[model samples]
Every structure is written in C-alpha cells, then in structure tokens.
Target: MQLHHSIGGTGFPILCLHGHPGSGGCMSVFSEHLSQRFRTIAPDLRGYGKSRVSGTFEMSDHLLDLESLLDRLGIDRTLVLGWSLGGILAMELALRSPWRVTGLILVATAARPRGSHPPISWQDNLFTGLAGVVNWVKPGCRWNIDTLGRRSLFRYLLGRQSPEAYRYIAREATPAYLRTSPTATRALRQALRAGYDRLGELETLTCPALVLAGERDRHITAASSRETAGRLPNAEFYCYPDTAHLLPWEISDRIRADIDRWLDAHPEVLRP
Candidate 1:
C-alpha cells in the first residue's frame, strides 16, 4: 500500500514512525521540531490515519510498507525516529537494512515488551471512539466530553505521566486516534501482549542509536529500553523522570535538543 505521509524541512531525512493507535500526524510535533535541522518524513501506518486498511493485515506488512515507502521516496539512507510500536519498527529496520539507517532515536519502546501496560476500558474505548469521530468530522471543534474522554484515556494508559505533561500530551493524540481501524489496533495490541523480543539481535546494528524511555512509562518499561541500549554496540540511553509513554510531548524541548546533539555529533549524517 502507498502509505500517506507528512514531510517537512530539507536536509538529511529522518523517517518518523508513530506507534499503534496513532497516525503520522501524531508525530508531527517531533517531526516539525527536527525539520529545522533535518528533513522529517512522518508516515501513517497501514491501519492508522489516512492510510487505512480494511479487513486484516500482518505486522510484517507494516515493515514492508516502511521499506517500500523509503524506496518510493528515493531515500537510500536516513535517520529513524520511532515511538512505542514505531520504535520496534525502527529497531527492525536498522537490523534488516543496516546500511540504510544512519542513526536511530527510539522513544518509549522496548526490545522485549513486558506486556504489563494497562488496557483501555470498554467505557473509555467508547468515549475515545466517539471523540475520534467527532474530531475528524468537525475539525477544531472539541467538546467538553471530547477533552474529558481523551485525557482520561491518556491518563489511564500513562499512569506515570505527570499532570503537567498533559499540556502537550493530548494536543495531537486525540486526533491521531481519529478514524483508526479498530481491527488493526486490536491486532497490534495483541502482538505486543504476545511479546515481541529482539534483544539478541541488537548487537548487529552498526548505526549510532539513542534510546529514550520515561521513568514512569506504563506502556513500555524503562528497564527494557535501557537493556536494548546495552545490547546495542554503540547506543546511548536516557530515562526522563516524571515522564510516561508520551515522552516526546512530555519532554519535548529536552528530547529535541538531545536529538540535535546526537545528530550533530555525527556530521556525516547531519551535513546536508
């Protein structure tokens, strides 16, 4: 499938991948921030955002879509920034095509998921679904119930997230979940729950990588990300205190600066 994508700035490319229950637009903040220094390409996955897929699709299809998207865009080599499920894809991409990945920025993700994250309740799901539909049908029109539902769901999933963080967290997330395929979301959640392990394969990636995790992330544990960094030959890991699954939004400025430092450190990848 030709995945719908959002692009910004111009320089070395950075493919920004969003997580499950999310769209390319979900990563817009991160992409836009990095765009000033590097070209950022954010693509909505097959079952998310504008690239919706009906019926059923496998996780392998997601991987294939990324490779094909790169091919379509004529991106031979680039940096990759992934969040949650997107981070898993980033690791897989670096492992499968080492020559194509110059560096990796992994956030709120793990090599082997603990599957301890909480699930949204049926009530919350109903609220989210409705809010999503409303947000999509009428742009910039949000109701009190919509904000309540979105924030409630986010809080539940990100139990460790700080109250102050919500200022930036729910800004784009509410819309990303809009028009998402429930079937695809459920399948992806099941896969994560089933355990996707790739620790042993990390040593093979030669690209410079920066792994980040929130100290309080309920979704993917910080220990897992740290372990992933340990397994990689050349990788740096950072854990932000008072943070949760939405690390990008919670610690936007800090993370962006760190990303800039990491990229600039490797002039070969940063130079236009």
Candidate 2:
C-alpha cells in the first residue's frame, strides 16, 4: 500500500481519518482547529485519493495499514477521529489494537454497513460490465460536478452548505476512482457487504469512545449511532440536530467543543 498523509499540531497524537470517495485532504476543514491542541495526522485511505493499493483490498487491509502508520510515526497511543467509512475503520483499529488507541471519536458512521447488500445495485452491476461502451457513448455521463451534486448520498453527507462552497469543495475533493477504477468500486461494494458488525466486540474496547451523528443524516441513520454507543461500555453518543452526514464540515466548531469537554473529562485516556 502506498499511503498519503499530512501531519501537524503539537500535543498528544490525534489521527483524523477521512471518509470513502475522498482523500486525507477532506479533513482540511478541521485540521487547523485540531492542530491547535494535537499532533494531528490525516491520511487518505488506500485506493482513495493518492493512496495506492498493490493487491486485493479488504477492510482488514485498511486496519493493517493504519497500524503500520502509527508504528512508522512512532506514535505509541493516539486518539482517533474518523468520519463515515473512516469512522468504521477507527472502531476496528481500537478493537484490534486497544493499547495503541488512546480513545476514539466516530462521526457519521455505524457499527454495521449502511445497507444490507453490497455498495452496488443491479443497475450498477450492469453498468460496470458495460463501462467501456458507456464511456465511449457518453464520455462525461459517469462523473461530473452535476452528477455528484445530485447524489442523495452526497447531499446526506454534506447536509446544507452554500451551493458555491459545496461546488468548489466537491470539485477539489472528489476522487478520480469515483469515475474510473472498477477495482476500487468493486472493493467498496464488497467491503460494505462484509459490513462492520462488531457490537459484541465493543465490550472488549478498553479506551473511551465518543459516537457522533448528524440528526439529518440520510446515509447512516442517527439511530445507528445510538445503537453503536449503547453497545460500547465506555461510549457516549451525541447528535448534531439539523445537521447532515458531514458533521465535521457542517458543524466543526460544535464538534470540536464537544470533543474538548469530553477529553477534559477523560484526561486519563490522554496520558502517555
């Protein structure tokens, strides 16, 4: 795996993991705030953005990569804040390496995958098979700012931002694989099918956790966040009312404030 990352800040290490279909740069909105109080590290997960994957991709591949990243950084223990797909990965990392994870902040994610089936539908499957023809016939139909803007998933995740701001960010943040690679697309579909059901495993998490969700999230329902928090012995759940799936971008300051209070109350978790 070839990983791309950005490291900043000065205190206890806090690793920020971006969601699917985006790169480490997605965290640009919150990096400055987090940097004021932490040694922040944000990385594009494999197969997304500039990260390169050499073999078959699995959810576990991401877990292992994150573990190696921390090891390479010489970070003994760190607080992890993950959004969407990244949130699910953060939970897995904490479960698999309790000692390495000091605490966890899961936003806009669930303990299980959003849908019962894979990431693709029958239409999508057919489209994938005829991708070459479709590309030839309609070169710009697959991915464009307009197409992305119309996606319910995008709306659900982004909530309500200025149209111009949303368009600007989308243009810069959207990944190339979202339009090109069948392999990356297939990996997401397959991984979601496998799901992130770890309710039973939550009992084993020694570190404190904060589960956050947007009240208006159309993708992962707020109920899922509640369910996730209830399963963890040391977890608290918070919902940002009227917000959408992109809680970090939609309401970064509020999220940061909550995190500050949560950390202050649980200082033991921050000690090296």
Candidate 3:
C-alpha cells in the first residue's frame, strides 16, 4: 500500500496518524504549525485516503506499514502523534518497536476498549444511525452552512473546521477503498469495535508519552485519558477545555506548544 503522506520541515521526524473516518489530510490543521519545528509526516493508513489494502486490516498491519515506511525513508527513530483510532495504533507501535518510536502523543483515545462507559442515549443512537444511512446512500453529500443548528453540532463534534475544510472533507477526504471495498469497510468497522487492551504492555514501553483529551468529548471521557496516562510509566496528561474529539483542529496552537515544550524537556528522545 502507498500511504498518502504530507512531509515538510527539517528536524527530528514526527509521524502523525489520524483518526477513523478521516485521512491524513485531516492533519492539515496542524501541518503548518508543527512543520515549523518538526519534520511531520502524516500518512493515510491502509484503506483510508489513497492507501491500498492488500489483505486483512489489523492494528498490527498498520504498525508494520509504519515501520517499513520509516525504514524506506531512512528514519531510524521518530516521535509519533496519533488521534482517536490512530492513538491506539501509536501505542501499539511504541510497544511493539520501542527503539523505532522515541516518543508518543495520544489524543482522544484510551489504552483499552472503553467498556464501563454508559450506553449512548437513544437520540444520539438515532442520529448516528441516520448519519450512517446518509453516508451509505449519498457519501458525496455536503452539509450546508445555512443550517446554523446543524453546523453548530458539526463544530461541536469536530472542532471549528472552516467551511472550505468541510467541503474538502465531503468531496475528497474519504478513501476510494472505503467507498468501494466492502471487505475493507467491514474490516475497519470490526477494528473500531475491537478496541485495545494494552495496559500491561504499556509498562514495557521506554518512550515518553503524552495523553491529551478534550473536556467535552463524550465518546472518550477525560477520565479515560487520565487512566491511560497513569498506566504508562513515563506519560503526561493534558485536557483541552470546551473542545470535543478533534483537539488538533480545535486547539492546534496549544497542542503544538505542549508538544514543543515536551520535546524541549526531553531532548534526548527527540534528538535532531
């Protein structure tokens, strides 16, 4: 698979992996800011964006792809920032290949499948089901800005994305594999449902980690991020107030600053 990637800047590499239902292009929100200090490489994982899926889709498959990509690019070690589903993958990568990953930044994710959280409200479930139907029938449909209420909900769920960003997302963000391949879609859905259970494995990780969560994120509560941070021997935690799942877009500057400070504090791990 040829991972679609955006690469820029001149420093120790920071590989960014985006969340589910999104491609690496979604990281455009952070690209310009983080690129000033780090060589950020954001790749659309297998079955997302322009990346291809040769066989099964698993967290391990994504990890192997990342490792191969780094080796192919002559990068020995890198800092990793992964959001949502990507965060889980980042943790797995760090645990599986500790030497290759020097540091980690996990956002809107948990160390394991969130089992104890309350079930979704009926209204939320209805909306999600409707959205899934809409996605299936009219995948290219775009949301209108005139609908202020709906727009507000979108902003609440996804952060403050510009109108143009929404348009790009509606038109170009979805991968061909996701739209066309049933097997890939099924595998992805299954993976999202499977979640992670690596609290025990996290102890073996020598790399420092940062766990970030949005205060208003209902999907993954702030407590989950806190617990995830606690499980890691060398992990720090931060919460973004008034934000939801999309912290990178909602507070890119803050996220970048936190990462900058963290890197400065651990220069040995983020060597140029």
Candidate 4:
C-alpha cells in the first residue's frame, strides 16, 4: 500500500511512526518540533489515515510498506523514530535492513510483548477498556475527546498529556482508527501480543538506538525499556519521572533535544 504521509522541514530525514489505532497525524506535534532542524516525515500505516490496504496484514507488511515508501521517495536510508507500536516496527525495520536505517529513537516501547513489563494494574485496565470502547463506538467522533481525556484516565495514561495531545487523538488517532478496518487492527494487535521476542536480535542492530520511557508508564514499564536498551549493542535508555506512555506527545521538547544530542554523537547517520 502507498501509505499517506506528512513531510516537512529540511535536513537529515527522520521518519516518525505512530502507535496502533493512530496515524502519522498523532506525531504532528513532535514532527513540527523537529522540523525546524531536521526533515520529519510521518506516515499513516496501511489501513489508517489515507493509506489503503487489502485483507489481513502483519508487521512484515507494514515493514514492506515503509521500505516501499522510502524507495518511492528516493530515500536510501534515514533516521527512524517510532512511538509505542511504531517502536517495535522501527526495531524490526532496522533488524531486517540495517543498511536502510541510520539511527533509531524508540519512545515508550518494549522489546517484547506487553507481558514483558509489569502487569498492568486494574485502574490502568479500566482506562484501557474505556479507550477500546471509545475506539469501537466512535473512533472518528470528535465529541468523545473530553471523556477519553478525563482527568482520571489521562492521569493513568500519563500524568496527563497536554491538551494538544488530547486534541490530536480526537482529531487524528480516533479518525485513523475508524478508517482502519477492524479485521486489520485485530490482526496487527494479535501479532503484537503473540509474545514476539527479539532480545537476542537487538545485539545485531548496528545502528545506534535511543530508548525513551516514562517512569510512570503503566503500559511499558521503565524496567522493560531498560532491559531492551541493555540488549542492544549501542543503545541508551532515558526515563522521565512522572511521565507515562505518551512520551512522544507529552515530552516533545525533551525528546527533540535528546535527538539532537544523539545525532551529534552518531554524526555518521546525519549524512542524508
């Protein structure tokens, strides 16, 4: 599928990938922040946003879609920044085609399945169920933004994502979820939950990796992120106190600065 995307700024390219039930639009805030110093491209995966897909698909299909996108854009290789599920995709891409990735920035993600982290608490599960219902009932409904961002829920997801972040979910992620076929989302989620392990493979990733997480992240604990970083040959792990799973959106400024430092250390990848 020819996935739809948004590209801006000018410099070394950084492809930003969003999490499940969301599109490239979810990363709009982060992309805008980095666009001033780096070229940022965010693509809506197949079956989300303006992208099109047929039948069931897995991570392999998503990886191929990205490769095809880079090929069409005449980009041989570029920096990849992925959030949540997108982080998994980033690692997979770098693992499968190390030559095509210059560097990796993984935000609020784990190296394995959700079970690798501490078990989610009942409170977190409540919000998770609420989100699922909202997505199923009116994934594109802008009106449900307030309820989804209710203080209690937001507190669990993150100390609290910014209003802009909430709005992005209302305007972008929600619609993208609605646009995606249920069957497709189910297949992708199932695959992600199938205990996919890549700890042994992380050592093979030649590209430098920066793993960012929140100390308060209920979805993927800081321990999980640290474990993932430890497995990588060249990886650095950073955890923000009081932060949560919405690291990409909640801490864009910090992330951009960190990326700058990471890029400086790995100047080899800056060559577009």
Local distance difference test scores for all models: 0.78, 0.72, 0.71, 0.78
What shift in Å separates residue 113 of candidate 4 from its native position after superposition?
A: 3.3
Estimate, for each residue in 173-230, the C-alpha lDDT of model 3 and write its tens digit. 4342244344446665687577646777778886888888888776667777888899
Give the Cα error of residue 24 in candidate 4, in Å: 0.7
Q: Candidate 1: lDDT of 218?
A: 73
lDDT of 4 by residue, 1-272 (tens): 78899999998889999887778888886788889888889998877777877677767888999999999988888999988888989999998999989888998887874533345577656765575466455553444445554523555565544654555555665567678667558777688668778888898987888999888887777788889999988888898887788765666677778877887888887775
Candidate 4: pairs in clash? none
Sort order, TM-score high to low:
1, 4, 2, 3
TM-score computed on alpha carbons, candidate 1:
0.84
Poorest 10 consecutive residues of model 3 by lDDT?
144-153
The window of 10 residues in a row where model 1 has the poorest summed lDDT is: 159-168
True-structure lDDT of candidate 3: 0.71
Over 4 Å off in model 1, which ranges?
118-153, 156-170
Write down the TM-score of every candidate. 0.84, 0.80, 0.79, 0.83
Give the runs in model 3 whose Cα sits over 4 Å from its true position: 115-184, 192-195
lDDT of 1 by residue, 1-272 (tens): 99999989998899999987788888876888888877889999998889978788778788899999999999999889999999999998888888888888899888886534666678777765665455445533435333653455655455344433443334566656666798777778777668778999888987788898888777788888888889988888899987778777766788888887877787765433
lDDT at 160 for candidate 2? 57
| lDDT-better candidate, 1 vs 2 | 1
